[model samples]
Target: MTTRPRTPSRTPSRRALLRAMAALPVAALVLGEAPGLLGTALAAAPPSGSATRYTIVPFLNSDDGTVNVYQSDDATDFRLVQSSAYTPPSNRIRDASVFKHTDGYYYLTYTTHTWQDVSTTIGFARSSDRVGWTFLYDYTVPIANLSRAWAPEWFVDSDGSVNVIVSCSTTNDEWIFTPYVLKAANSALTAWSSPVALSGIGANHIDTFIVRIGSTYHAFTKNETAKYIEYATASSLTGPYTITRTGDWAGWGSYREGPALVQLDNGGWRIFFDGYGDGNYYYSDSYDTFATWSAPTALPGISGTARHFTVVKETVTGGVSITKNATRSLRSVNYTTRYWEEQSALLNLPVVTSSSATADKQAATFTVVAGLADANGYSFRDAAGNYLRHYNYRGRFDANDGTSTFAKDATFVARTGTASGAVRFESYNYPGYYLRHYNYQLRLERSDGTDLFRQDSSFVPATAWA
Candidate 1:
């Protein structure tokens, strides 16, 4: 060890799950970890009059060579949207983290080369839609004798500035990694200010993810020597940080790295990490911020597959070209003045001659997203991110139970309406059942092959009320 007073190095053991453990998911479950761990789930019903918000996880697959996109209404259960959604023309897509920029673009920052390469650069790609990506550029760290630059994660500051926290080392064979900060010099995010070394997160650490709550900055980083993630705090973004929790702190054990945290709408936080030594992915929850955590649980379907990826909780509206990004109101074909509405969680046809009142408008609007069971079909999501699903064949607005049954119950295949310029929805699971309203109440009933059923089932997508 040098008395250089600085320089962070490698967690030799953590390399076990680095690119070595990277990989793949769409199934969601409550945030449960190792049995007996406390799990926090969404409220049975979310507060009404909200917009559609989703948690998106973009990750690097171990055997594959691309970034995969998975989405969730709740942070616990994830639904796979795209496999190999985006790939840079060259270089390995490791430690890929995604963030939506202020300019209406989804941006990705990742380690450009595989672990074997001595690299000074982190790569970036941009997409107007999360599905299609165009390579932006590779940013070279200005460090002399830069041995490795890895896990460039976006930390958009409270002040709206964009910065990437990347760990760097001077020795290639010996990855002496410490987290460094690079501020975006341009709105394009292609250019950056010179890297600033993070104080106290000294050598032998990697994959540092930081989040700001109120005024304090909490840093969760891998302590290479201990092979466990440690928590640190500082007043400034660049810190002479204080390591508050070390061994067994937060109950997240040794041989863990790639820490990423996402805040839940329920006022809780979930931290995800790679248990590389065991080739598993795990997550823990903290209701009182990072002070306490639930036991680490294997991410259902995703635990063994995904490595070192970040999950972003974002609220989107009326901007992106993806039809799902925009919320729409379904107008009944038979009742021209009426639209679909949710009243006390029940789906009903309500008369709304105009989009004049906010209450009336929100009840009639739904966010349309790819079907949870079959992406080819469509699912209708309510303001609180719940789905317009059928329960016992009765139309009801319910939260995604993170079950295939719920996905199927919620999904509907669109068919040409009996009337021109309208559409009828055929239930995805019960093929014969269509979303036809009876007694002004929405329900999944089999078409009686009557004109009444056709008109009742058919609806036209109109402007969003909210």
Candidate 2:
């Protein structure tokens, strides 16, 4: 029983859907295929630039219970690639795990229900050719001494060691599956190590996915209560890891699971996840501290069952990558205590001028002009001074703006009331967030003590930075 979101009555094809979303101000290549149609499709091919194609599995046939694959040169268009239904000697197939190994082969693992039809086990298979696969192991590992297993994510360590993280629980208690990690090698399931518990993480974490960003390993897990994703960092592939960033969890949202993360060839991370009710997957770039994300919109297609999505660098002919200029401005501010980050450099208030009014009625307005930056949202705060009302960001504070910022570089208008005092813009950048404004300070400071380019207030009506 896979849970899929409901689709809109008048859903468009992938090409039409991408074309509709292309109207937003999100950062990406904007191209025109026809009137009211826009996408990332490029006629000319290059070794590296944009995602020339998209591949999906388990296409038309939902039965045979096989994992289908599809390919699209454009984000809006897709075609079938391959499908594999590895039953692994088990009676049923449920959750599946797929990854591209360093050895240049694709590896897949799925949860298999035991003969009793109550217990679940883990199975492994590999494919050099995407179509046909060879079964590697079968029903050798019972899911962490439990009868249930789901959502397996494969991680390859620096030394060619493969690690598996999964959601598991007692077969009878289907709603209580906990997340766990296991160690293994390319050899077989008999050589796999026992499950290791992760510190500072909880059983509530579900639909988990792990990725290697630079030298650090990060984990993104869905917090059902918060209704969003949370992030954790670990020094080693498997161990006592700590949750560093918890995204918008308690807000009015749903699903937000099935994280498909792919590092673009042009040095950006594209994360695809399902929106709870929209029956469509959403892609977000320029993530802030894993706690904050730009507003998520439906992906190009309406077919919503993406238990997990995978990305592979095409080495064959017709593969091309494009250099995407990230126009997202993430303004961040660091206070003595707590931290703040902006969804985009552009926010409701981009400029703030000192006023005689007190914190209760200090009338300050800033404009975030669209088309200047690929800003999806904005946040502001008085980091240096304490006022009666300070901005709170997801239980953390010292930031404000609106719940969301403008998607494009459009000018947004905002006024600060008496409760809120001096305002600053949130800076969004890779890995870290920096404060763009302090009370009466116009310069922005990087989290690592480096200084970003700053503009003098004398030339501008209000102190601001972009």
Candidate 3:
């Protein structure tokens, strides 16, 4: 059995490292757009919701022949989330990638192999929630002469088609590794199309990540021989991509691999790759069209040894107020349901139903305004911009146009709903009382306190003001 080196000696000087990188025939292809065109193309757009970045790192346990799953909220800090032993036809799992689909499913793909044994099979699994995963099938590349498969990364197109790019060796005798593309037959990924080589003959490529920025598709891959992250761009997903850029930013001598790219919230891009020589992850950022990058910086807070991994953003939407409270009630345009008053001797409160509005309590029209407290929180405003406030002490809610001050009472936290594009609101001050639908009417009441509130409390996106 051939044992892979756990760590390589990091004794090379900075001067020697730079000299090694400079010796390579690095090419730079600059496809510059007009300043106005670039601005319009790369303009930052608000995400559907508050996005959370999630990363999956694999910890290969040779002793137990198991791979432990470590996850991170921020890319730096990681914690063990799951661990499973290797089963038959597979010895261990490594170089895992996690991809979240629009259908609310996360698919995990990893390289399956015995100890030092090369194989063409890649393990696959799917999870509704990120926690519990169900093993699907061993996705064997249809290449008849393939020797080994490594690092598999999945990309879902805008049209919902699923494609996976994997690095594999052609034969068992040679270490030449190249990337191959495979398209999933269906969203479930039960079957796949025949594998096609991404790179030309004699060109070594590994750890590939495909990212679409504006109208162009960019593929970032590690040149195994040169040990640097190189990039290629094409107008289409599956294409004859042009080699645009190539260089080792870390200048760590040819020990870096597994390049991953993520678009930051600031409309910039960050590239993360493993510094295998130093046994650490390093990152660099680009703000100006990926032309140049900041110096590679070492990431902190990572505990265990993580090999190839991938990061994805979790889409979360915020909440918005539909209507206000006053002499006028809030009515749904699609339904006869109107926010009406439940007149009682003890307490008169607002409820949404098919009941007709009275003269004393007419339907109230509200402007769904942005939140004053936070971007995720929303304020229910009257036409005049008066917010609806919830009294935390007494649980009394009212739409008061009198006060100019925007407090917690006027703000509600928006959480994504179970249904697609739906959102639920929770009182910012009184977290217990969620703005939910009760008795088929809109009411501020304590949630069943389940994992999520009912569908009635959920509201889909209506028209937004210009």
Candidate 4:
């Protein structure tokens, strides 16, 4: 399996690295908007005033294997990264849950088989930068006549042991599913111990997701019989779990499943669940853990599209990133020795040497700023104070003329790249187009879905040379 190599000049900060776990980024899709939602506090907006960023990429159940990526500053709204962003080789990609490993790569655990099919295995895939994914071998769950293994979620315990909790159906009806744990033997999560049955969580339970708060283990699972999400707690990973609240405990009504939780920046908890019976999606908040929760609030726009899926949230400082308001150099992904340089208004790739001139370094440096068009996006300002924008799809260093067109042309969204930890800048107005080098000249071009195109468009946001 290929992975991106970290830049030697700098790595992610120690604090940032320690703060993130794969299961940490989740929920709050809707909090205070719902009528019954009371006693819950609103979280501050992120990536603008706050330091955090929220994202949810849900896969359609009908999709053969497509997974769409999303980005958001606040948990309230989300923007699609791309459609069919990544698809596994075969079967369905249902409940594609994601989390960032300590290795700095994003990993997914998914339901490989359809709900009706007698599935014996779960799907696994890993991405270096969350853009391109490489499929690993399918892991067979050790269950006799296993009808289905659905909603596999990543759980990194306090002891740092990576485990996956899955609801397994041993019956042919697929109605009775018991939660099971598969412990990873190594950091890579490739080798795992045989499935061990969860002690207290018995039959007729599915979509079991667990999170640890303080020393207590909180499990939010669905009861197929009662048609309501039940809350449980345990002192250990595999617990003699105790059900604390059951049957409309949060007033979410019946037919609620797929319970997931995310910790807000305010230290509150946001839980997302699927209102499948009503054909909608909802979220609720709890300021004091799950002891007390607000009423269910329906999620806008994503009510039907995201039936069962995964999301992510982390500090922007955690990953290899180009900081806004800071100066940085763009190093070519395919040509690491070359940097983007401005000469006579046009952008070009110039090879860097040990004896590279100071003037050349100054031309390579650009100050990263919030996008004039979309604040969540970014724009580059050069040493000469000119913004780099596309003119007739050609990249150039030109002054911002303060026009609406100029703002759109200058804005870009940095997307995770292919196997290089570098980021590719997708054009703001043109979704599939990227700033790429052709014959060493920079231009905005539409992706032809080629490896050469991905390599060409990708660039590392390196330390500023000037």
Candidate 5:
């Protein structure tokens, strides 16, 4: 195994780290004014606000048969990085996906099979810097004990709620458990909402991925006999999804599983699903939906059966990164953490904004608008540089009035911090958290504990208002 040199570690104040995590940029796609079942929360927007520049994050098996990360910036040229070990449950990770949430964490969900029975569970890990990562939560209970929830895909809504779409064939009359989306809160396996069905569409569904475009929630699932891709759209994530037998495949058993929705650079959509077989990879492209693809092309020699794949363009120190990783590890852990703040300069900082009547509110009414871009303890920062806050998803912050919910949006107090230019928010979670701008400067502990990467341009916030 090829190991990269350990990075230096210099512990920064808790406040500094919190600010870093909370500072990741948010660019809301202003869709048409419509709120129905298709009314998607802000979480479903395409990655990096671009609909072009289609890329793929491929999962590779090591020479020693461990799991590592290999990325293709252009879907054609692939390279590998010595990442964490892939301790499998059995032969290998059959199918998987690298799910990026609006809350700034990426989830790796996959299916693993052993000798006796087929089993699968969603492994939840986090990357504070979106590069180096700390494995956080792996489900104790298999998501569904049926024939196995294969290739689970994750989705986050505007309400800070998360859902997963998994494929399975159950014993309860329904032969195929039918690929459906299940809601999971934070990483709690028990906290998952009940399954929502997707059957009325097809029988052989596997590796389902859903993306919100405009007002429709589009689902991309793989069919066996047809060896073709199918799509469905609904207003809600947990939906009565309307089926569209829209597209077909190229190679035999070519388009197998793991259908990921990626936005292109020229402002369009590209479906990056896996092509199952030896020596060759399967992929299909379309600048316009409801139209025929240019045919399922081959991205050959990328990996040995690269099934589950995800793609995202993240702002990294070296340059922008398109990271891809997966899971089927034998051992894992799940933990719960919480963070609270004393409302410091970071939380109550002011931005330069002129006042308008629409911005004004009634007196003494604290309108706790929960969805601030950098509002969580994950984004906590203290001017004193002493305190640190770990903003895990379970953490929550509340204003007065008996209402509290954990999420990434900011809270607007109608009376106190609600006044324009009155609140400046900052917080940090573990890791080099996201910042809107590339110029964020701060003190951060490196891997070696003694050395640190401080005040780097990569940490800077690009948008001042953010």
Candidate 6:
């Protein structure tokens, strides 16, 4: 005879009750439509710009015994993208993390049990498109003394290697959780390296999320003992990390957990987490550094019942494109050592070999503003909001303050790169000629119908806004 599932003796917290209520029609009411109706109502329209932003949440369905997918364009508003149950062998999924790798596949990793249980395994899945996912493998950490695993998050390194970090507890002391790192053999999730403890032996850490700032890897984690969010940084992914900062910012309530971070379209960073036992997600922004944060505010447009969701900026139409509306430092294909510099007070080009000689004078940050037709073209803008215009019949390129007057002249068709991750900008007014670098300067020149022109016109993605 089949036995009924046992309910643990521990009292359910307010957040736990909210999570249960989230499996009901609350999301439908917040979205103002039936959850099942979303599949047909929201067709896959072309994204506004070259890239699209998405927030992914995996919620446990109380009715179906499966994990449901909720997605949002703006973090505030959400829709049930996948009403179909995502069921693994363990029949539960929580703390979901999704990553789109350089190999052009989406990978999702999650814990296989509810919050109270001792989970020994984590589930993995892969998808060509984010909508449909296929189960890949379940990873069981090789630690003989380990008792539980929770909140697994994976990152794809610059070298195309995949690494997963999870909160794990040992059999000796099951109450305290520490972070562990596991390296995958490949994108297919075929094999994994033995788990290595990321935190010190007795340190209690959970809900870890890793992000790369320049060459440094910063791991933001929930300190179980301190009851606050703390960040640590390391030179490499596998690290002896140094705790850089700790403590919740002013106005954040006593209880905060599950830290998720996303870089905004305007060169700022926002950190999100559940706060105040209300089940609503609160957010804080850091304009300069992660050390200091603004007053916590309830993120608008999200369900008050959601928890442990992740937001990632993705390219919907274009293949691996840059984030739109953000300032970026563009480097030249021909002059690999030089960058497209805004030299002098005027809008003339002078390639700079070193960004440090006159750092402010080397302020070459250009924002990729959208064009008239969403898919047709784009315009580049300076930090002061001046439009970079191709004037005099594609004869020269300069930043013009004329706004919409030069918008048509400033717009250029964005061509996909011949290489997988490269992109080219071609003039709209002049078809053959593209924005290219020559003699350490910017100019519009004819392609001459060769790979060299494509190479000269091509550029690697901007590292960060100068």
Report how far residue 276 has shifted in candidate 2, in Å. Answer: 4.7
| TM-score for candidate 1 | 0.61
lDDT of each residue in 1-466, candidate 1, tens digit only:
1011110022323376333422211001112211211122222212222212344444544543587777644444455778788878887778887777667777888988777677788989987877788898887899878888998888877666788999998854345688999998988887899899999878878889888766788899998768899999888889988999998887877889889876654345778888877766777777676888877766655666676887655443321122555688888998888899999998899898664588878888889887676664678888888888877667788877787777777877665565666777766654435788888888887554456767888888889877
Show how many residue pairs clash in every candidate, following the order shown: 20, 48, 9, 2, 57, 2
State the local distance difference test value for candidate 2. Answer: 0.42
Query: Which candidate number maximizes TM-score?
Result: 1
Q: Write the per-residue lDDT of candidate 2 for residues 312-331, one digit (tens) a residue.
A: 43423422211122222222
Alpha-carbon local distance difference test for all models: 0.71, 0.42, 0.54, 0.71, 0.38, 0.59
lDDT-wise, the better of 2 and 5 is 2
| Per-model root-mean-square deviation over C-alphas | 15.0, 18.2, 14.9, 16.0, 20.4, 18.1
* Model 6 C-alpha lDDT per residue in residues 1-466, reported as the tens digit of each score: 1121111122343234434643556230001012211011121212344433454755432321355566543333345677643566545667777766556666678877665566788888767767777777777877778777888876655455677888887777665678888887764677899888874323677778777766777778877766677878887776778886666543455557777776543334667776635555676766575866666666544435455656645434543345677777776665666666565533333455444566643366677777533233577766666666655423233556455445545766565555656667665543334677665556676454456767777776666535
TM-scores vs. true structure, each candidate:
0.61, 0.52, 0.56, 0.59, 0.50, 0.58
- Model 4 residue 315 CA deviation (Å) reads 0.5
lDDT of 2 at 407: 16
Query: Candidate 5 residues 111-143, lDDT tens each?
Result: 554212444455545544334545444553343
> Candidate 5: where are CA atoms >4 Å away?
1-65, 83-92, 101-104, 114-116, 129-145, 158-160, 172-177, 187-190, 246-255, 277-279, 300-305, 315-466
Candidate 3, residues 1-466, lDDT tens digits: the string is 1111111133332223434543655310011122211011221222334533344645342322344565432233345676552232445666677766546677778777642455788988767756666777886787767877878887655455678888777653335577788887875678899887764322577788887766777788877667777778777776677877766543434667777766533345766777766656666666676777666666543422555667654433342233322223333322334342323211123434334344323223345555555444566654444456544222233545443333555666565454665556655543334565445445565444244344545555433211
Better of 1 and 5 by lDDT: 1
* Model 2 lowest lDDT segment of ten: 409-418
